[model samples]
Target: MGSLRFISSPFSATIQDLGREALAYYAIPASGALDKKSLQLANKILGNPLHAPCIEFSFTPGKIEFESATTICLTGADMQFKVNDKIIKLNSIVGIKSGDILSGSWPKLNARCYLAVKAKLDLPNIYASYSSYPNAKIGYNSGANLKKGDQIHWKEIPLNVSLENIKVDDKPFCESIKIKKAPEYHLYSKDITDQLIANEFSIDSNSNRMGARLLEKIIGDKFPELKASVPVLPGFIQLTPSGTLIVILQDGHTTGGYPRIAYIPENELSAFNQNAPRKKFKFKLV
Candidate 1:
């Protein structure tokens, strides 16, 4: 077994896999990598299972040191990772040796980064997932976010295994995010609905894995609340009583009382998750 030690942790870091599924019946939140596609791509480069565990770094994963030889790949946000002053390209396998140091800064493009190591992380699974859900104290390090000086042990990949180095172009940022009419779409008038599609929205700074809060108040008038809290899922966009829009994400509540005005498509959820705070975009109704 080898280990990777965080010399200095990122703004927020967590060990995550694909997250728990079908456990909502128990009121459990499916807290997983916000950018699911990135997580899968990173693992793919390392020849690991698509749903293998990876370190999800937010803002910046300041510094990390390899305690032994291993292989790794990075995907998602362009954190501009480097080793010994050499830039390490994303989506490509990079070999790590003992005492090697890796570092990165705040991403210039997306909100998060995924690092996949060619090894099995020694973390206990909660509800059949290695994903972290800090709110409920489930996952790595007892559901605590990673911090500086933390060490993660793992079983290294065998030397005989062949590693492939792959490269993929970074996706361009699209200002228009696609959405579909929700169950409560009838609650609003044509004018209000038209205004929503016509106006642009900015992601709020307070947004997190739980939800992405849009800055615009498309619904200018107060609306009656839902009769009861309805079941919600990732991509469900809830219109608040105050006129704000909140898009439920991976860690969002399974139920909400706000009006479900529209929802992003399942395939586009990862793209929307990459939208950093203050980024502006329009809703492309489909």
Candidate 2:
């Protein structure tokens, strides 16, 4: 098996695989790639299993040099990507030979991006996952983001490699995420609930994997002083005491103290995870 040596990994970059599902019981959020659908599709395009290891870049661009011939794919943000100074398109697979230089630019549209080599990477596994949970220091390179001069390993490509192009629809990225009324939904007035569904909200700048604060429409509420810590999930819609709304995301805490007004539909949680600050998002109740 040949390894993909990281000549340089940009700040906030991390090599991750699909996360450990069992760890969720311990309240460890499934910390992996934010744009999972895009990651899986990129792997599928190169005949790799859907959950194969890939590089997840956050906000910054990355650069690497391949030591062996390999197939690769990039998805999610339309960050300016180049191989040996030649620009490449996003959401498509490409082939690279040894000694080739791959580089990417800060995203122009989205925040995160996935880079999958033809084979899986070798890293320490915790509970059967190579995903990194930096807070807990579990799995991969001290469970922290990737840095310069780190070495990564990948499985060898099978000789019977078959090539096929997989087309991905834009629906997943553009569709509105749906939500279901949570137990606390009734606490707010009908008008407030209506505003939540009808108004377009912007992603707050103070956002990260832990959660996202929404610049939502001001909905006058009767209980402005409400503050009760409660259990929360990836899509929980929590309301702060000051009437600000927050949509919990993938790396969000297992429990929260705010009043969870509604829960974003499970299927759409991924949509919210990848949205950059200032991007407009609307919701629909299922």
Best by lDDT: 1
For each candidate in the order shown, give its overall lDDT on alpha carbons: 0.85, 0.75
Least lDDT summed over 10 consecutive residues: which range in candidate 1? Answer: 158-167
Tens-place lDDT per residue, model 2, 49-133, is 8887688887765678888888788887777889988999877768788888888777755677888887767778877777787
Q: Which pairs of residues collide in model 2? A: 229-257
lDDT of 1 by residue, 157-234 (tens): 763334345456578356789999999988888887897899988889888778889887876666658889999989
**All candidates: TM-score:** 0.94, 0.89
- Of candidate 2, the 10-residue stretch with the lowest lDDT total is 158-167
Q: Candidate 2's error at 247, in angstroms? A: 2.1
User: Which pairs in model 1 have colliding backbones?
Assistant: none
Q: Which regions in candidate 2 have their CA more than 4 angstroms from the true location?
A: 5-11, 159-165, 221-228
